[model samples]
Target: MRMSMTDLEPSRVEPEERVVILDFGSQYGHLIARRVRELGVYSVVLPHHAPLAEILRHRPRGVILSGGPASVYEPGAPQCDPGLWQAGVPVLGICYGMQLMVHQLGGRVDRADHREYGPATLEVEEPGRLLAGLGPRVDVWMSHGDRVDALPPGFTVLARTAGSPYAAVEGGDGRWLGVQFHPEVAHTPRGREILANFLYRVCGCKGGWSMAEFVERAVPALRRQLAGARALCALSGGVDSAVAAALVHRAIGPRLICVFVDTGLLREGEVEEVRSIFTGLGMDLRVVDARDRFLAALDGLADPEAKRKAVGETFIRVFEEEARRLEAQVGAIPFLVQGTTYPDVIESGGGAAATIKSHHNVGGLPADLEFQLVEPLRDLFKDEVREVGRRLGLPPAIVDRQPFPGPGLAIRMIGPVTAERLQRLRACDRIVREEIRRAGLEDRLWQAFAVLTGTPTVGVMGDRRTYGEAVAVRAVTSDDGMTADWARLPYEVLDRIARRLANEVEGVNRVVYDVTSKPPATIEWE
Candidate 1:
């Protein structure tokens, strides 16, 4: 739990040195911010209509306007602060953003005769500050229905494609730039370079921000906030919660109590595994067997969000009861520590990010919860958290553990959660995990688990045919949990998993592999 002073002093950057991304509800808005951080500069995503003063309060080095689904001429299309141009900061606009900027700056933008939807050849006519270093001819990804027809007072074309006359343009003082293509997507080969030019060449950023700097700032901040007070941590044995507990343990030492809730939704042997790991680290670990309570809370719930909220509410009640019991021994425990990551915050409807799903730790918590949450890793991605864990001196086994959702198998099951179904799914999950690791892919893949699809399938185990439940196996590869692709697991690995599920796991007569990725289907079945 103790960290060396050397690990705590890495020459951090001030939080004010960052780029502010004005989100126009583009699916790529969060990705834009991720790419900016990948370039070693901090960035944040705000709603398009954020107050001019609020956007400037960050002392942003630059501003980026994200593309949206709406057209610029639409009745109620999102708009940014007109004062942004007068803020004297560099700004880059993309897609619909470009059209909006052009329209608001006294330029004309109209629907194109033929909208560009995919790959296009960019013929760089000028290669101004934003497009500099990219070759004269580059392949870019474009998706838009409108194009700029006329230039604003001080604007000129920088590049053009077959579909649009002004694919890229620069205006007034070289501080305003616009591109009709999305630079944050992987489809654009040199997109990262374009973003780098804006961050470094245009905004003049120092590129000093990093995960190491984040840890240095967070440790002291947690200490100052929880000084002379006790905190309880929800230690779920996953990297997020484990790392969160480790950081809090470093800050408050023995005053930090780690609670492991056995909600009966966990995979087989997981409870034992967690107990061994943290207890060996000398943590103040306590286990609560709230299996019956969680099941009762989720008895009739078949909807994913409802089950999540039920489990979330049930979890808080258990923690509050435990907190009261511990008060007599430790005086008081007012804070609940969680390993909530950036993806969790955004997906839970934080700020301009859409609410894709309500994460158990983020959106699932009860409104009247007693403890204030201390989330040290709230703004970091999954990969960044592993780096922080390594910096905190945690072992590789804990640092590199694949992600597990907070709602656990409850979310993995496709229907009503029952004791029979829970055990069957747990066994199936163990087989999948075992086969994956036996193939030496446990570390290679982001997550590999089993889902109990409530639908039954006809199968034959002996001389006669039998109908039993089908189990779906899911495995994905991802850098951050925000985006993922179906892992191309070896056929042999897949075969072993399927065979084990059918032969060893009772009630699972058929097995299937899930090939859907994150965009269309999340990592978890729910």
Candidate 2:
């Protein structure tokens, strides 16, 4: 059927050479797993209570014990299978994970009189294989309450900090290792290099997994699912929804209905651009302009969650009506596809971590909506999704499109979802993007957009005092959305962006740049 999502029966991705991470209920566990995968190795995180037999089934070349919130001596503290170490595989434990290992191997761990919660300096005493060439003193990130009182037999202290006598240890002739600090976090300066060293030098792992490999495996699996069925994908013009719909189009061919609901809250020229991009790929794209209806549903709503939920319900109604219209033309379309990623699932409380926010597509869907959901790129990150899109022959315009939230500019409007405010924010957003593109910084940026704070500031325009809405220009640089730093844009670019928004955008008089990082203020203000 000539498809862009392409075809293949996904072959097994090295269960033998994989690094199996044991999760002990730490929020950082998944981050640890992601760090390992970024090292170009196949890695998976299993529940802390996973059976010993299940652990052996992966036939892992190495194992990592993730940090947890619980102390090692708590009554119901999570514990690894004692046989886990007996498996004779190399292991590296972090934080609570390190404490658990010490207790298991006949060492004492107790609550410390002084708990280390942030940064600490480590003095590398022995410079063991793990700490080789790490210099005389290493700055490490520490977040733990328990300290190892004594080392287990046959273990040597590689590094030590002021708060804890033991910070890093090595035993079993370099086969076993533990660290009190978390190397998965960005706060730890040498985290990535250390993980890479473990993967390449210690475990002797060869990375064979790529996003292209994922594409080959997923295409055929999707084809098998939609063999004779007609599926409808919800298109948001963002990377996730676009990639999801395009992949399904490659599988189902003419049997796919790609519905794009234009809620009038999208950026300038977005609706037209989206339709043109999809149709250029020979996709059966359907554009539904239910913007008035969406604004109507969100009328008088001020809270972010309330506005998001309203938008979600309205989107379902629009899609349902669109589905009915499509069903009339083509016999029946039953499957509904979405590009809900792993971070979305985890942030929406579908993973081990608590709910951070409700994504409109994943968590904001109405309970009574009537369609089967199909998400092909559910497990990939944003960068991974872009790679799959490239392999599917999607042009850079779509593949490299900066990620937009599911609720569109409705969430960015920061106030009532009226057409007036939508237009203002859209204009400001357009100027921000145009200036970034003009400076040739668009490709390097993670996201660059204008967020309307819905607050007005006074300005003198041609010697006349005027009050108008203020827009904050947000630009960030990030490998993933998990953590981000504000992009240090050049003064020339910033000056141009600010000057254009004030001069060109009608209702915008004040333009401000957000300098806060992700830890304190999210990239998206709302």
List, residue by residue over 281-373, the lDDT tens digit for candidate 2. 898888888877988899999888888788877887788778888777887776788888867766666534656677787678776666666
RMSD of each: 4.6, 4.8
* Model 2 spans > 4 angstroms off: 1-17, 22-30, 46-62, 68-90, 103-106, 110-140, 143-146, 152-156, 170-176, 185-190, 200-204, 458-465
* lDDT values, one for every candidate: 0.87, 0.82
Q: Distance (Å) between predicted and true CA of 22, model 2?
A: 4.5
TM-score of 2: 0.85
Using TM-score as the measure, which candidate wins? 1
lDDT of 1 by residue, 1-526 (tens): 2232233221122475899999897655778888999999998778999999999888899999999988888899889999998989999998888888899999998889997999999999999888899889989999998889998999999999999899999996899999999999899989999999999999999897888888777878888878779989988899999999998898789999999999999988999999998999889999999999999999999999998888888887898899999999989887888888878878888776578889988778766667767778877778888988988888888999888889989999998999999999888888888888888888889998989889989999987798999999999998887788999999988888888888888887888888998887778878
In model 1, state the lDDT of residue 308: 86
Error of 1 at 154 (Å): 1.1
Model 2 gets an lDDT of 0.82
Q: In candidate 2, where is summed lDDT lowest over 10 consecutive residues?
A: 1-10
Tell me the lDDT of candidate 1.
0.87
